[model samples]
Target: MRTQSVLVYDGDCAFCTTCVNFAERRLRPRCESTPWQFADLAALGVTQQRAEYEVLWVTPAGRVHGGAQGVAKLLLSAGKGWAVLGALLTVPPVRWVARGVYRLVADHRDRMPGGTPACALPAHLRPSAESPATAD
Candidate 1:
């Protein structure tokens, strides 16, 4: 967060883009969504590798939340319903489950709707997981 809150994601992944579309249309948070590639990563204190691994929620306070927490934080910026949902998801057992589920979806995003084999992370960035990593 550099005075402005933002949802940082991968620009090269279609699956990621699809999710972002849903967030924009449905959640309609006050925050802005930007591809990490187009954002000032150094300024945001976001590493390229971290951005490749998970969605990030950067707050004006410079607090960074990753994965399920990040999603929840982004939703928290939306209206009442979304804020409630976000709060619920960020709590105890729900947060634990959300993390696992997020990992599952992220790990197999190439098989998800709007996903493609090309959605996989680049070689160098992927040090594991079938000689490469899953989608962004």
Candidate 2:
């Protein structure tokens, strides 16, 4: 069997969580799912600050994927119909299109569900003075 990868995503973002939940239901039987957290990201060699700025995925081969590419990879690994989607996403033009869409969604995420400042950083877990600001 192919080695499964670790998916890293924002646990607080409702939209993100919803999508992950869907993926989990469809992919869980095949792969591993891991919530994106400061410690887990750090251990994966990805800075918490970086992960906070975007979604990430760590392939079993130690390769890292982010954004639409990450999602495509996850679906592809999930087996069945998504596998075809993943394969198609790897094509040059399709890959470009996929990334572009991912960028649009990510850029406008603040307007999407579970995108409020409170959701991004709940009062109880606000960033400390030492934490790095969001990446540009």
Candidate 3:
């Protein structure tokens, strides 16, 4: 069994929506995902700005994980070969690189799979891609 978590993502982005659908079919984590625009952010301790900028995992216990870490937790909870990849991504050097890559892809996501020019979050909503600190 899996503990419930809310996987908050950008519903308006086609790339993000397709990625969520991919996870739904492949990872099959127990979490229920929603666009932050519709989910109750206050109840989850997630800021709308943050949700707009990155993936968020909020557990029933109120534990919050954001960005790549959030994706990692979701994969591990899914219980499959995917967990191994998720675990590896959490290791030190790989974790560092993974976060960087995640940010890079996020910044260029309008060019990613299923992405469209209009799939991007507004400029104000996008964190400074140069500063990892800002994304957190």
Best by TM-score: 1
- C-alpha lDDT of all candidate models, in order: 0.84, 0.70, 0.84
TM-score of each: 0.86, 0.75, 0.85
* 1-136: candidate 2 lDDT, tens digit per residue: 2276777777666667777888777565255666665336655767666566677777767788888878888878878887898888878999999999888877666577656554446323644323444544
* Segments in model 1 whose C-alpha atoms lie over 4 Å from true places: 123-136
Q: What is the lDDT of residue 22 in candidate 2?
A: 80
What is the C-alpha RMSD, rounded to one decimal, of candidate 3?
A: 7.5
Q: Which stretches of candidate 2 lie over 4 Å from their true place?
A: 1-3, 27-29, 113-136
Q: Which pairs of residues have clashing backbones in candidate 1?
A: none
Candidate 3 versus the native: TM-score?
0.85
Q: What digit string (tens of lDDT, one per residue) describes model 1 on residues 1-136? A: 2556899987777899999999999889878799987888887778988998999998877778999999998888886889998998899999999999999998888899998786775734433334324446
- How far residue 33's Cα lies from its native spot in candidate 2, in Å, is 2.0
Which window of ten consecutive residues has the lowest lDDT sum in model 1? Answer: 123-132
Higher-lDDT candidate among 1 and 2?
A: 1
Candidate 3 weakest ten by summed lDDT: 123-132
